[model samples]
Target: MQLWRRFTHRLRSRQAGDALLALPLGLIVVIVLADVLAARLPLGPSLLIVAPALTASFASTLVTGAIAAVAVAGMLIIGLDSHLLGTVDYGSQFFALLVVSGVVTVFCYLRERRARELALVRMVSEATQRAVLRPLPRQIGPLRVASMYLAAQEQSLMGGDLYAAIRTPTGTRLIIGDVMGKGLTAISDAALLLGAFRESAHRQADLPELAAYLDRSVCWNLAEPSEVETAGECFITAALLDIPDALPLIHMVSCGHPPPLLLRARQVSALRATKPAPPLGLGELTAAVYHVDTFAFEPEELLLLHTDGVIEARDARGAFYPLAERASSWTLHSPSALIRHLRTDLLAHVGGHLTDDAAVIAVQHTFRQTPTVVHTTDDSA
Candidate 1:
């Protein structure tokens, strides 16, 4: 049974890996035969294979398709050289090859153009992702950080969910926020929130001031005075934290966001922030004040900040994922490992696409030893 299971696993893995490569391989074989037969025919066969070759190459990696074309060309050359035909028939054969080559060249050109277009799209997506949710550094002073951002929609690099972290003079400041909607508008809101937080966190000394700054920025940037009446209007839920010089202590503020999870000794617990404050853009009506809550962080502790995409992720059976529960059993030590595990679990939970942008940031603090003092009382006396 064990051997069978291993073999089955390997077979499945190979099938998944080869799915994209099959089209080009099949085309290469078919085109090679067509090129050989065309050389012997009275009329040029080059044009015949053009569409098939080009289609195959276009659907797969350029290099693979190119190799197929080279193979076909070589076969044609050999057929012409061998007395495979009554005569050289240079006119017909030359034109046939010319047509074939032209088609190949055109196909390659189109493929290149398509590749450029895709690259441009990807570049724009990446730029947008960065602008919306700037990356957190791997190391911020005494903290080691790792983050992962997964767009629910394939081919998209950025979405409504966002996160950012910076080592400010006040200490390590980080924010994880989720916009109310999805797509371009949500991305704009995310960008606005991150930009505001970054600027305010640097300038404002306290967490409440930073939160207020973010609130004003979002309200001013997102909506006009007329749109404030709607209850379900767009807004952002966020959790912001400041890790000051006094290591193992965190000053946090939560704005209608899920509490961050703290991992210590392989256990997960929620770090309670003050009572829920209205989301960033909605506080304009009541003008509610944001509260700053403090928590102690033990050495070798991990702080996990994530968007609702994680908590709300549902499996095929409609069971929502419990990150804290699942993560409790995870033995991964590093930030990357944690992200990888979380991503895998998330994919398994959703059985495929997440349908929402998901972002996670994990931070671990390692304590530095303070120097011990030695007394020189005898010499001084």
Candidate 2:
């Protein structure tokens, strides 16, 4: 009885294994039969056969598809040798079958290789993003910060939009800027600007000095000897914010960029700079200095800094998305939540893609807690 049970178990295992392999094998068989029938019909060569054969080849392991191909080729050879078609040359039919099988195999191999390369590129890009945009802590001074940076192209790992926040003896200094163009040159320029900003922010006493420092650094380092004549032409639109410890005020210096958006309860407005400043690198020739604009930041209010990429993003209908109007309804509760909502809404507005790199930083002053109210009865006296 034990031996009988063992034999029955072996048979069941074999059946299960065969069932698992049946669907793909069946598909291959059907495709081969269809090809053979189509070839025999009045309809010339079986070009339709190539589709299923290539699909099977790419979707399954090379060995499995190779086996199927070999089997089909063998069947074709046998059919030809048996003179199945009247007055048709056997050698010619056999050669044609061989050629088709070879072509399908090569195509499948190339496609599989391309897929592997794409996956590798995606993995590298994700890794680079984490390295470049490290997570911001919950709070910086009185401000709660959250930010998002998105590349314009699908496969790109990085681009020109840049932002940085650093605590210094001067104050909590922040920068938001966009490089002139895209690709490797833009990334290079962005890195240069951020590096200069961080170094200068710690050392410089005021916003104007810091701006001048950055301008000089970029002018000296970015311009090639041959491009000296065009040095004044290249510049970055940047906004620098310095939050002082003494009062509930934020000092801002805008360099030809869009003004920061300020959000208070039920009201959203642009903290427009009173004096328009020339962009960095352009002010070197002119002795005129840029002035900083000051605005009050009550607790629970939000400030948004962004790049032109956000303002310039267009939808399928070719209309530019109005950031001010769209972000008006946003409630700044947490940095991550605010950024998440903005990213989703922005992508949806543009229908899944933007023509340029985009970035947004949302900061809220959370130190001044809301006062609690209590009711008192006056009628008791």
Candidate 3:
């Protein structure tokens, strides 16, 4: 059953491509009709070569060869009718037409093979991205959440920045971070952090504990496999937040990362950390000390957590993007709407290019809905 379905799907996809088949067939028909109508012309079916040339563009190698065969047969008929089939002139024309058609058919086959290989590579890349950075759920407990990732690498869908939301008995736990460097090295570190957070976030009792656990885990990964020496500056800057379902306050911990932005009543403010800690993976010398800072998350307020790639984006004048100022005007919008506006504005500011990987997570606090009570009566009575 699966094989049949796959075959049907491919057939449906090819229906739109029937025009490619029609082009060659239509040209061949015209050549034959023109030969009959314009027999008096000195040229002997010279236009028939067009059929195979057009076929090479959209047809397979086999189809191109078949079209070439038809053209050769037509040439032979025209030669015999013109009393030129046994002459040197006929042999030369036939050889030229055969060489051109054969070359086109081989070239088209090679081009199509390269295109298929690229499509396969792209599929593998997409699968890796999905596993490394899973998509965030739009609705988590009592919060309306939205997230986006913008990669700086060309032809790449993911990079060193990361974010994740894990719901637990306590609250909706959130993380947003950026790892130094780019390409494969940064992406590997980002994936390691995301995996550790998801595994330990719910088990840890407090925000500080969760942060410390992640920091220690990253430190362990950065340490030399066979020795106690650790890699220098191989750290990840991160911010963690916990928003309980029943309160209008948020608990946060920052580790050498930019502070989260709070948008309330058309006002924007940075929720700075009281006692900052060093970035993860540097606990030995720095002895990372995390502190949970409480912030007001009023109703209709939107909290924006983003990587530095956003604020550091530069315009033609080399000025950084004013995220807080511009985001204040979007306080009245929902989480998804605010993200959409920011994405478009950021691209426009940087002239449609980003220099680093960027990630954004917007959490909105809205009015709680009253539970609906359904009352039933005995209709039979």
Candidate 4:
């Protein structure tokens, strides 16, 4: 009895005027109308069970069970009025509906339990996301920053992609990275990387040094002494950037990561790295040395940093998402607007579902009143 009240309350509060309920209610009304208009069709009463079967999908288990009982009662009434309640045909019909209602009621109960469990999982995932992925501030010194994250798997709310911006003694530094894999394992790796960057960003003087420190951190944590570190798993593709408070120049170090796109004067251009280093964990493979590439970061310009999810996102036709081309026209937009447009457009491109975890960060250079920079710039070897 207590369970019944909870079920009915949930039903009443949710979709009170639902069109789906109309299916069952309209079926009841149609049966009554038909009984008056025609000689009783033998199979007419059997159709009543269909209502409860459909209700299991949208209504609570208890509500569905109640409707199933009502349907059985309606069938019995029709059988009695037709004077065939005890007949073999009536008995068969009655037994069949009884079995259907019982099966459907059990199914509905299990389905509701699973849905409740999934809700709990989603709540936990949300909390994990908030802790691991710290929200990027809109304004960081003279730059406007915005970030967006999309999980590939429906069950997981956060995944491997990560980005962070920190104000240090040297300047404003940012890191955009993608840890291999997806779901919890990948996110855990991403969180570790972000934590290391935050702790070391201030200590390191330049992008190359910061990237090297992060590479060492990742290699140490991921590769156990007993295990031999390989290339595929436990790797991170990342980009480190230094945008000083006063300089119009930006320094970058690409670690097997995609280069950032520069949006200037309603146009988009890729900042290709002349000498890129190996991904984070595999720093020992190559020179493991990231060349600090310097580029002019003028006011009113926007730099878009993203994981591979953006370019690799394929549509129904297997056409990859042209992020640079699409974003070229949105150069004039604010950081928030730029990210919003990319979020909506990317989802639409992939038919609202991504096959892999994705993240995009947009940083817009704002106008400053200061005429000259009192700081000295560092040169990379």
Error of 1 at 373 (Å): 6.0
- Give residue 204's error in model 3 in angstroms: 1.5
List candidate 1 segments past 4 Å from native: 1-108, 224-232, 368-381
lDDT of 4 by residue, 1-381 (tens): 999999999787676737677887678557744753577875687787787888877877887887788878778778767887889987888898899989999998898889899889888878878877888899998889999989898766678899888997646899999988877678878999999999999888777788889998888776766545543358899999998887787899998899899999878889989999988988865657679999998988999999999999999999999999999889999989999999999999999999998989999877464766699777873
Pairs of colliding residues, candidate 4: none
lDDT of 1: 0.75
* Top of the candidates by TM-score: 3
lDDT of 2 at 172: 85
Candidate 1 clashing pairs, residues 3+ apart or interchain: none
What RMSD, rounded to one decimal, does every model reach? Answer: 8.1, 9.4, 6.7, 7.5
* lDDT agreement of model 4 with the native: 0.85
Per-residue lDDT value at 34 in model 3: 65
Q: Which ranking of candidates, highest TM-score first? A: 3, 4, 2, 1
lDDT of candidate 3 over 1-381, digit per residue (tens):
999999999998788568678877777767666665687245546677788898887778888888899888877777766677787867787888899888988888898899899999999999989888999888888899999899999988889999999999967999999998899989988999999999999899999899889988887888757425537668899999999887788999999899999998899999999998888887667877889999989778899999999999999999999999999999999999999999999999999999998899999866464578999999999
Candidate 4 local lDDT, residue 364: 81
Q: After superposition, how far is residue 239 of candidate 3 from its true place, in Å?
A: 0.7
Weakest ten-residue segment in model 1 by summed lDDT: 43-52
Q: What TM-score would candidate 3 get against the native?
A: 0.83
Of 1 and 2, the candidate ranking higher by TM-score: 2
